[model samples]
Target: MHATKGTPDATRFLELLRLSVSLVLIIFAQITITGFVGFFVVFLPFLSSSYSPGSLLTGMKFLIAGFAFALPWLGYWWMMYSLSGNGRIRGFFLLLLTSYLALIFICMQIDPVYNPEAMIPGSARESTFLVCMAMSAVILFPFYSLGVYIFVLRPVKRPRKRYRFLLLCLLFAVAGLVLLPFLWHSAPIVYPGLLSFPE
Candidate 1:
């Protein structure tokens, strides 16, 4: 009954949640879900018998989290862009590599990567999570494909009446700008660096 109360948390092959009418809602798959996924992946590796607020505050872990968080949105956009026939496969690698490099550059500006500890050992919950991930992906493949195609891929492919490439540039620029603040806020929290955040 509780599961039936709210909306499905994901539309792209991972219905991990049914969002309630609370402050935490499933609004932007490109941001919200992907970002959460990134944070969690980093976190799970770090979780162990001992936990402190500061356990997750290492540089390498933070970088991995950033990559994890950013990947989904980047993959969503890039994958769609690739299928759109707007450019060659070379362009896809160029964009992905460059953007990821840019992200690394920004992080380096704040603090360089440092792997200070070994990963926590496997736990009982790992199996549960694996099963859930596999099942959801298998079950939701069709919906994921359809959702991305209808909402993202089609519009991407439709740009440019005769090669002018009207608004595609602006669309990407906006997406980049929107991603910056998330990366920014997350940096200080995850890495606990130059920026001083409130308590």
Candidate 2:
């Protein structure tokens, strides 16, 4: 009788599948919670009684902002799972963090004014750009550092030159940082207050 390594292999595969499912569940839950909070807090009050372009635009802003709020954490997990290499992960994390902040800048530019009372956890008019940027750097740095080293792109006796990969990461990070400010500054068409929420 031959003993087999099949059981351990099957168990490992199942574990990986479980982790993937968990990630999906986490994303779904985040989207749902953000959607509800965003609706009452940011969207509802903004809808208008009379249909208008401004109101439509405002509604769009809410949806975009909600997605933007959800993107960073999702992006983090996505990158964490997808890539392997400390330099690459660090670069990806930086780039993703930059992009996430860019979205915040986008939301700031949309700058829809809403009544505090209508919102569940009310928002403020000021830009959260800096805050998001700071948070991204602080939160992701350690994770990026730890993750890259742990996940093997290909195990090595000695590390190989990965300058090109590092350069690419830098380029992405720089591009994200540079373009976000401009995108953040562009003014939007209208504010749809009251209709989205209520009196």
Candidate 3:
């Protein structure tokens, strides 16, 4: 019996797998922390009332839902970040956009009680989801771009012409708005019943 040596491709694959697992763990931690804070904020008023138990349970449900809804985009951002190399400004911007989108989707899905209609296939629900996604992209793009410009790009290299950068950002904003509807239609909803709790 002899041990077989791993090929370069296999070794690279294993390295990627390890990196992915680590990234996932980090993302989960972030989501858990965020969820806990959100739950506390939303459920604080119910603490002194008879509805405390129910509120606590609902808050827990929201926490779980938030984690589920955020996982996909978080993973997407992590992968993008890992591949970004020196051009981290673009990557960070992408991360911000995805995070904002995740928050928007989670907020839209929240209810005192679970709604099964969100998961059911119907034209109305689909349209609503599409609209929400597009609206979120539209709302977040400018903020995301500005944050990138201020925090990421400005420190690295000052632009010779600030107006040109602003113009570019505006162009990107317009492009994002134009493409959002198509993206909304094409993108599959990752966690349709994310707000639901188990029976």
Top candidate on TM-score is: 3
Candidate 2, residues 1-199, lDDT tens digits: the string is 4437555566667767865565555445444543454444333455432322224443344334433543444454445555543434434444444444443444344434445565453332222232233233333434433333343232344354244334434543444345334433332212333123323
Which candidate comes out best when scored by lDDT? 3
Report the lDDT of model 1 for residue 183.
41
Candidate 2: regions farther than 4 A off: 1-20, 25-125, 128-169, 187-199
RMSD to the native, candidate 1?
A: 17.1
User: Residue 7 of model 2: what lDDT?
Assistant: 50
Count clashing residue pairs per candidate. Answer: 0, 7, 0
Error (Å) of candidate 3 at residue 134 is 16
Question: In model 1, where is the ten-residue run with the lowest total lDDT?
Answer: 18-27
lDDT of 1 by residue, 111-172 (tens): 32223352843332232222222222223333333333344444545443223222332343
**Sorted by TM-score, highest first, which candidate order results?**
3, 2, 1
lDDT of 1: 0.37
- Per-candidate TM equals 0.26, 0.28, 0.31
Score each candidate by Cα lDDT. Answer: 0.37, 0.40, 0.44
